[model samples]
Target: MSQLELRGIRIQLRSQSSPLIELPELTIQQGEIVVLMGPSGSGKSSLLHWLVGDSLPEFDCSGEIRVGGVRVDALPTQARRIGLRMQQPWLFPHLTVRENLQCAQRGTETPAERARQLQACLDAFGIAHLSEQAPDVMSGGQAARVALARAILNQPAVMLLDEPFSSLDTATREEVRAWTFAQLARQGLPTLLVTHDIQDIPEHAQVIYV
Candidate 1:
């Protein structure tokens, strides 16, 4: 289990002048789900960007992002161990689901072990049958599940969700949202979910309004 804490964080975007966002303090314990809800341009997405060490080139940020007690601001994005799932379900159009999972496998020793890990991840998300399918052939909900499976295959310390459920119909959205949250809980990964829809949140989440 891993913990994530943000202390005295401030982020600013530089154009000619600076636009800033200040956050007092926030903490998310291991295995907890924290939802950040706010309207567009309220700095919700920027907060995630800062945490994941992928703040846009135009932004200037000063803050402390600690994951499992390690200061991550100075670390590279891959070293941050944060998994991000965005609304677009950004899987490669050219890769099969199995290939996508393979891409996220972090330093598994042997080919067989890597295959086993990928299989387990697909099974966990109930999409093992779709492993050979191309991304374009999968349904929206299925693609979302594959995206999340790929994210967790890396065993990230914390998962960042940026309105992942926004693109589906009500029924599909509800199903995928439930599956995504359940997988996060089972993996015991702390999660930060950013969404505009309150209805998509699971009952167990601790919500913070930005």
Candidate 2:
């Protein structure tokens, strides 16, 4: 329901260090993708952390992060309702794939409604068969898909993906990237993706080199 917004953003590793990434503003419209690329230590991930209200202890930032025109910089990580998927699946080692997705459905929807939504997410990600499987048993591509499904199940207002497809083989990476983009497009979620690989950039995306 909201696009991602960052205004007057400046991030410093230390108070005395120069800003790593400074931006007057950056916006990703609904259903659009923004590819954030930069050299090592240039703070691409730091920008995402800042936007999600979880700046690392080594960093200090000044910015106004808004979703749907409402400031969320002051909100707690969970309160912000921002979705994130990293290079690893990061699913609970103790839970099955279905449980992982169920745990992410923390919204106010009714139980019946939530179940329907969860099933749809599993089906959409093509992981219905893996629902009862443990996360450790899944292949790289399957784990990535599980992560994507969990993120989508959360129904985030905006999402930040940090090399979500990096861990896959070339062919698998391409397939998962296409599937992920398709799902994101279907939901019209404003997403910021960080990657060093140019192939990961979707068509007509806005790229920001930090």
Candidate 3:
């Protein structure tokens, strides 16, 4: 029943008086994906940073963010219970794929149950073979898949994606995008996706221009 709600969102450069992005309200229900599209410097990513509770030292942001009717804007990033996948993959270079994914474990599942889900996710993402490899050894596509697996494993209340499929080949990109949307829908995770490509938008997604 968790839904992401944002009200009175306004972001602006600290050095300027004009707002970079402003929206009166936005709501993303569980199992729903909302796409944010805009030009290169239109504050799409900045809005997501604000949602994820990231430090925006260069910009000033004002908004109310809530999940399931509870305020989360004042909470720390981790405390806000949101997962983010950026264009860079952001996997741990020092750890093996499996270990990196293990770092995302946050549920109370037993060891056996956890292992089962991990393998299932790896297989689902077509990355089971890369489980023992380091991030540096994987291709951009592989790394992206691994990064996505970790993000889902984290089981956040909301998922924020920042051009997550931009690195994949055409065919892989479509496949991964479809699978990702399906998985998120199945899990009932509210999602906000930022992308420049219209092809990235899923059917029925609420598209907002920044």
TM-score of each model, in listed order: 0.94, 0.95, 0.91
lDDT of 2 at 132: 98
- What lDDT, from 0 to 1, does candidate 3 have? 0.89
Residue 73, model 3: lDDT of 95
| Local accuracy of candidate 2 as per-residue lDDT tens digits, 1-210 | 588888999988886658898889888889999999877678888777777777588888888888888888899988886898877889998999999999999878999999999898888778999999999888888989899889878879898999888779999999999989998998899999998889999999999897
**Looking at model 2, which ten-residue stretch has the lowest summed lDDT?**
46-55
RMSD of 1: 1.7
lDDT of 1 by residue, 1-210 (tens): 499888888767676364456767878888898888988876778878878888577677777888999988899999999998888889999999999888898884698888788887888789989999999999999999999988888889999999999999989998888888888888888889999888967888888876
Worst 10 residues of 1 by lDDT: 15-24
Per-candidate local distance difference test: 0.86, 0.87, 0.89
Model 3 lDDT, residue 161, Cα: 96
The top-ranked prediction according to lDDT is 3
lDDT of 3 at 70: 88
Report the C-alpha lDDT of model 3 over 121-167, residue by residue, as the tens digit: 78877789999999998887678778878998887889999988988
Rank candidates, TM-score, best first: 2, 1, 3
Model 1: residue 203 alpha-carbon error in angstroms: 1.4
